[model samples]
Target: AYEYTLKAEKVCEEGTQKQIPLYDHYFFSILICAEVFKLDSSFHDQAKKIAYKNLKNLKKVQTQMPKNFRSRYLLAKAVIKMNFSPNLKKEISFDFLSVIGVANEDNYLHIEGIACEIYGRFLKDKGIHLDGAHYLKRALGLYERWGANFKVQAIANEISNIQNDDFNKEININSFIEISESLSNERDLEVIFKNILETAITFSNSLKGAIFRRDHNQYFVISNVNNDISHYPQSIIDYAYNSNQIVRIDSIFDLEDFSKDKYFTNNQVRSLLALPLVANGEVESVLYLENSKVDKVFTADKTRILEIISTQMALSIKNAYLFKNLEKLVSERTEELEKKTHQLQISSGEKQTLIRVLCHDLANLLMSSRISFKRLNKKLKELELSDPDITRYLKKIDSSFTNQSHVIDNVRHLELAKEKGFQITLTTVDFLKTLTNSIDTFEQQISTKKINIVINENLNDIEVLSDELCLGVNILNNLISNAIKFTFEGGKISFGLQDDDQEYYYIYIKDSGIGMKDQMVRNMFQDNIHTSTRGTNSEPGSGFGLSIIKSYVNKMNGDISVTSKHKDDFPEESGTTFILKLKKAV
Candidate 1:
């Protein structure tokens, strides 16, 4: 900006008649700024005299000021010099807009540069320090790039002063940590803000300050020094909310335009400031402070202090909300878990009782069967004849013995699984071929029921890491048997698995059978529990198959789900959907 201003200096030295209007404004603007950014206050007297002389010169040419020239550039420079001015601030209450609008249309650079300075200055003046210093630093770079050295230096000076203030305001690391610990006792959000604001005002040597929050359907007067303003009308709150920004009115005459309004006309307030309180990306309330007398407006220093306090205010509010939410969620989840734990304990007791009954019945039946077999064998030996009658008696005895052994083998298989950890010995296996083989092994029973077993279609050549010799046979044996037992002779049974990005597979086996009710689905995993009725042929099942399937699936880190429908509800779509998720082989 100085580089551009230096060009104007050359024009002034030459006394160029054509460029007089532009050169003079540019010169006076730069001369005023030469100190705040560069000229030390040691020359404040000399600089002030020069400023007063330029002001008179500017007034003489005010009517002839080039309407086409960008006036904002000059206005922004003026604001920069007067921003912290004890006297200039009192003289010119106009902001960047007031200065920039003085120029006619077609001067955008001046307007934009001046706008940036105002926004930065406004934040610094009001205690909204967050992003202010950084914003100014960035604007300085832009002006430097635009070759506006005057604006650049002004911005740099502001930053330097702010940084110094920040340094002085900072607490020692140990003290900061101690203060943080003390804040823990200060939990309620409103109380925290009230204390912080009251303390800040006292330290800054300011008179009474008040804070307000807009709750739904009510404006809650949260913080104050002497008394309450809760009786204040809604119109005042509405103006603050409508603006959604920080508004400072230092003089009553400045707010005379709002006299028609009910709240402002009656408040009898002299100086006021309203700033929106933001926390956790949401605007929960408004924060404002007012002084009835003494100062006409909030100073830049006061605004800086407030900006620092606003950060603490936001953090406290956010922490309070999170703490409240976490407490509620934890309480709800704990109650649900406690209810489920109680149900599980009751179920465990019932399972113990059922096991005792089954154990007693099995012991009595085994003893009776053993005694009958011994007597039958002895009778057959006594006959000792090679006749057809002897042969028939021996055949009956042999058949009875074979049936007893089959029952014992089945019970032993299930019991051994209960004793040993479910050890899975996985190997590379052809998934489709193994599945078909298991279904064929069950053909005898399926044929007796006259049920159709469909391979349907092979989805793709998929390999899975599994215990082919055991799990494949076990999983399919249970699934196909259940399907044939429940489904009619012509019912469909289909199996498929697809591969995807995770090097995993989804193994599905669906059957057109008697679909389950919602209650039955939840209970399907229970040991010795099956809710559906018998098949079309009145076949009986143990219901232990599904319980074992789930256990094996857990061992393999796979998942399964079922979806079912009833023709009575939906006529055309009536089959059950069983889906299983499995990892694919490498």
Candidate 2:
């Protein structure tokens, strides 16, 4: 069938112009060929080549293929890889298990069944008869559900052959299955230790047993069952641990002065078996079982089974301890991160409060100085003597004082806005009247600079839903003051407003000024970057105006953006335009 499909695909690609169907046939043919080759040892080399080729093609077209098809292809490739490399069996097994998980999640029952069957066969060939039988039974159940009678029979036959080959091996397989299931299910170290102790007692046919675990080179009993014995003879446990060998005593009377040992004498132990659990050449734990009524109850076969169980138990317990410690470390680190985050918030609030206080104090001092200067100017005029140099110096001092006061006032407003989280009390604000007030505030500067202020006629009656007193006025005042400062003498500053679909009011402020560079414009509204630059007339600036304007605009649920070009780059096009979009008043 696979050869026929490949030939049909080739015919379609060459003659029929049906590319999609041809690709589908090609994918299925490769998949079927790989599976067919996997069943016979003589075809293993062919299977490996086809499987890898399929994997390469799947990678090229997986996104175009169905998810179930992709998962099945991966499973087939993993099976071939396992058969090809003996040294990579463990790695291939993990890959096979992962594919099984994804197949189960996707409810691809056919892929799940095939994966289980292949894994069972692999384990059986490796002499892991117990695990092999477990997987085979699972595959048998899946096949029965799907009504695949042939597959069910094949899997059941394999299981039967494994069981009938060795009777003692069957018992050990059952014990191992039970132990593996218990270890997989239980995570708590105490619970795991108790489960292992119970299984050990049952397998060794002992009346009572206890497991002592090593912690920091100290031995302590971690689990016990059906025994009132609190402590074991330290001498025997030490001998087994230090010698890295099993210590068994069939008859206590065989040793000289054995009655002097309190543990054996008091408990009347007839026979005892102690096995050391070693990992990486280090003794990690010891399993001690005692039979009070029977002599020589623990046989060599039972000891061997116990040895396997003890080795697996040691590794499981170590994993549980490591997991517990990892959880503790994660919790501690999370707590530390939360503490630092809270401290940062408090520090930010404190810094804002300090800025408000400092600005307020500076504003008060400036007001007093302005008043004293007014009186000093009046007295000088009364004296009827005016020196041009003295007059110019006094005017310069007054200008410096005025600029400093304006900067302080703006800073105080900004701090208040931040402290209240930019909260605005909404009110109907006449946009035209707000712009008029801002222009009036900067009238003296505009006149001094000989700047032409242009207002669009359409803005005469515009109104917006905003806080007119704090948010609206502050936003307009900052933008206009910036324009007046940056504009050269006799330059023009224009203001305009337009409504868009009755939803928002757009305001524009453009100025023919010594414009900013692209990098400067990008960082102007960010407080982290210091963007203060002198005006064309060498007038000082605080660099806080644009930041304050952005915050106020956001508070009113508005957006603001700027466009500019450096005068050195394009002298004729060198100017700035600030665009503000605000919600319309209803």
Candidate 3:
């Protein structure tokens, strides 16, 4: 891809198109070379130089594209700086944080995955395997969703190796996760600043604190006390802000050189520190802290943690700004739509509009929560602790978020049904392949219940006419879930495929578990009838899955039926079987 793009660039430079817009191609070339640099150490030197030149070219024409592309550009910058430009180590964290924040905000999974993977590798090379593993695992999840199976396998292998080490550092996982979630959930800038100051004061044992944000060439002060800049010494703040470093003083009066300085001479302060918050290669803010009575309040370990907090603050601030801008854009778009479609907005259209708005907002909220989880995972890794219990808890948390995502998908599909009336495009889908993937979606649940899945025969060559999304996510997925829900531990769920006639094929799923009454099974797909029953484990349902499945099946010109005998009536062979008949694609 890189070579072909480079050839195209040369051809365009030779006057075929005269000033062709190849920035996107250049951006991709940078990414390809950057990945090569990451995977192969031998290509580091050449890859870095090539990627760096492309980055410079990208920067020149960045304004011609949408602001979202800035995240990708920053990612490329982080890759080059992390692997090749060692002198810019101080700026590496900021670059990665900004890239991640923007990528998460924009829902750019691939970009986020690449950033996390490279960041993980960077941490691993620094001997922080625990944190590296956390990032690699995050990258693994993102890649899996992006359908990059090869990359997912590679990252999983990397995470396994990292976790093999015996790391048992004690950490307060709940507290850190809470802090990260609090910061990530809030988009109000003032609230975030207050939280940052309060957390910094409490953790660092400071009497009072203030934050000064750099704007243009001036600094604006925000403090727990009065907004007076004179309340705190400006000299240390200036030094930290100008130099982009932390300044810690044990005692102001102890330094002989400071005796002439008016603020140090006049004040009774004992300990003071000024730390700069840098993001995207610039100083964003300065956090000034003081202890009037105590000496040496800011210790090394405290400072180290505070530095990490500063990085978090920078990321939160940038993300908040991004969200603010996006909200403005959304408001503008909504206003335009309202004006243009005012006459056409009927009752159904109004409901659809509301659903669209809610879906968009809910998606943003879910993304924010996921970002907080990633941050917490990163912090846990930073602690160098490798506890199985913590990992298990994290997985549970991740699973819950994934469930929320599925709910969002179902809601979106509901909106689609409302608008299109259960419309579906029938395509020739491989019957066995689709069924296998659908079953794999419930792999965790299946494994948990120790259920055996049996396929009657190989139907790899068979194809059926159906909508892929409807068949995979909506129909087959829901049916499989229902089977797993009612199926007892160590039960069996079997699948069989057959051609009942020249025009149609039959697919049957049978589960050997508790079955419903015949009358209830007959009315299962009725819209007004509530046929949902608690599973063996008392699992709850929305009572709408069957009706939706029936609608989708009818839309695809298919038929579905169920047969079952109650466990009380037939003790030896009580089970439920669902038979679906669809057209056999030629």
Highest lDDT among the candidates is held by which one? 3
Candidate 2 least-lDDT 10 residues? 165-174
- The digit string of per-residue lDDT tens for model 1 on 166-207 reads 433432222222222224334365666566555544433233
Candidate 2 C-alpha lDDT tens digits along 195-269: 777666644545567777766767667645433324576667777878888977777664453356676655777
List candidate 2 stretches off by more than 4 Å. 1-358, 366-410, 413-416, 419-422
- State the local distance difference test value for candidate 1: 0.56
Clashing pairs in 2: none
Residue range 1-586, candidate 3, lDDT tens digits: 6457668667665764424356666667787886677678887777677787888877766556536567778887887777677557569978988888889888989989989988888877776555666677678779989999999778766654553444322124444444444454455677777877876665555657999986786667888776777766777677788889888887765556345556776778877788888765677789898866556667666676677667656655665665666566556755554555446533556545755775787688669757756875786688676777678657866865775687577666775664567556789998888888788767778988999999887465778898876787778888999999999999999998745688988889899989999888878987544466788777655455787787778778898989997899998899999999988897
Global lDDT for candidate 3?
0.73
Ranking by lDDT: 3, 2, 1
Better of 1 and 2 by lDDT: 2
The alpha-carbon RMSD values of the candidates against the true structure, listed in the order shown, are: 31.6, 28.6, 24.1
